[model samples]
Target: MNIVACVKQVPDTEAQIKVKPDGSGIEEGGIKWVMNPYDEFGVEEALRLKEKNGGEVTIVCVGPARAMETIRTALAMGADKGIHISDPAFDGADAYTTASALAAAIKGIPHDIVFCGQRAIDDDSAQVGAVLAELLEIPQVTVVTKLEFAGNSVKVIRPIEGAQLLIECPFPCVVTAQKGLNEPRYASLPGIMKAKKKPVDVKDAGALGVSTDRKARVVRFVPPPARAAGKIICADDTPEGKAAELAKLLREEAKVI
Candidate 1:
């Protein structure tokens, strides 16, 4: 079996991003990049499945040339190889544009299954996998917490309101992974060394006959409004009194009851 995982380069969650002078985008300077958290789970799941069943795991990503760092990280994590689709025009594209471009990119290869994260940390739109599935005309399951492969078919487990649902789809399906699916591993010394020798092929979306002139432009990015500060309201001094006061206050002020 041949499996492909989609990865992305996203801003480090610890880093503080600065806006551009005119409020168009984030300031590129001093911005550190890392693999998207969701994508990491997808990669880990792919590697785990391949390790268990013995298949080739390939990583695919679309970003600037700097994205190779993320690809290399996945390589160290045990993907067999990688494909990088770097195009200047794709930089500001939205989920629609991204999925379309990736669909065109995959047109050049034959894949048995495709895996992606539930969403990118930066954007968190959480729609690319489904859009790609529509473009490819294949079945897709999102927010999957557990997965298993059988003869020419795959089963996925997704969580709903206080319940889990099991669904089955044919082979050559697309899956978007959710967190808690597995514990991700760090690359070892030997794996890092081997990553440097792994094959990574790069392609430009525009050069690959993929159109960049498309819909979805970034108008601007603004930070969310600050959260309100905490307040401590003292209740009765005794434990029982405090519990009663807390329940009363919650029902009245917080409106939970």
Candidate 2:
């Protein structure tokens, strides 16, 4: 089995974000980057599948050169190698453009299964994996919480509004991992040492023969408005008086009742 895991580099979830002075995008200075939290689940699932089925796990990422750090993190977590798609043309590329580039890269590699996070935290578009599956002409299951391999088929369980959905698909398919899929393993000392020697193939949009045209563009970015101050109410000593005061406030002042 040859498993491919799609990962992304995103700003650390806890990092403070501020809009650029020109309202074009977020300020990158002082912003720490890390592997997308959701993608970690996909990487962990791919590693588990490789361990069970005797295959190599390949990490794939699309970002600037700095994203190599994210790829190395995956390698340190047990992926066999990595593929990085980085090019100036890919800058400001929308989800479709990104998926097209990734699809081209995957086409050049041998893969029986592809794993991706449900969505990237930066954009939260959640469109790349499905689009890649469509471009590759393969079936896909999204938001998979549990997965099992049976011969050439895979069974997966995913959550819905108030229940779970069980799905099955054959080999050469895509799977987007959900939060409960598995716990990602931390990079050990030995793994980190070995990862330093792992091979990472870097490719660009032109090399992959994919177009970098973006179908959409961000017009401008605006920060959310400041929050309003809270109001406090003090009432009389009697329980009935306090109840009346609360009701009056809710109905007239707060207007919530």
Candidate 3:
């Protein structure tokens, strides 16, 4: 199996997010970054499939130069190689442009399967995987929690509202892995050393014929309003007084009563 998994670098989930002074975009200072967590499932699943079939797994990510760190992490975890498609134009490109860039990169490689996270952590756009499949004109599944190989076909189990649906599809398909699909393993010390020797391919969006600078641009960014402080009144507090206070705040202050 030649599995191509798409990964990404995102602001660390624990990092503090702040907008620029003029609200043009993220402050981009004093922020730590890491691999998109959801993408870990896709990487793990690809590695597992390679172990079973004795094939190759390649990871792809698009971001700034620092994004290579995220790719290196995957290589340490056992991917054969990685490709980074990035440029300044990609800084604020929307999901459509991003997907186009990915498809262009994938078009240059022949693989039996493509794996991706159900959604990116930063944008949470579940659009890329599905859009890339459409551009590639291949069968694809999303929100897949379980996968099994059977002869020439593969069976996928996807969670529904309260249950799951088991669907079978042929090989050479795309799948967006969901969380809990598998536990991601840590790279051993030796593996980390080996990753340094792994090959990394870097390409820009222009090389892929997809311009990162699109018609849309980030005009500004503003943080959400701060949460209001909460107050705790003793259970014995007067119910009438509490109700009256809530009414006054909702009606007079909130103005949405």
**Candidate 2 local lDDT, residue 117:** 94
RMSD (CA, Å), each prediction: 2.5, 2.3, 3.5
**Candidate 3 positional error at 145, Å:** 1.2
Residue pairs that clash (backbone atoms under 3 angstroms), model 3: 23-220, 23-221
lDDT of each candidate versus the true structure: 0.86, 0.92, 0.86
lDDT per residue, candidate 3, 196-226, as tens digits? Answer: 9999888986678876656545576789989
Candidate 2 local lDDT, 1-257, one digit each (tens): 99999999999999888999899998999989999998999999998988988999999899999999999999999999999999988877788998999899999899889999999988889989999999999999999999999889799998999999888999899999889999899999999999999999999877889889999777787888988986555576688887888899889987998
Candidate that beats the other on TM-score, 1 or 2, i.e. the better one: 2
Task: Order the candidates by lDDT, highest first.
Answer: 2, 1, 3
User: CA shift at 25, candidate 1, in angstroms?
Assistant: 0.8
Off by over 4 Å in 1: 227-257
Stretches of candidate 2 above 4 Å error?
A: 233-257
Model 3 stretches with alpha carbons more than 4 Å out: 213-218, 237-257
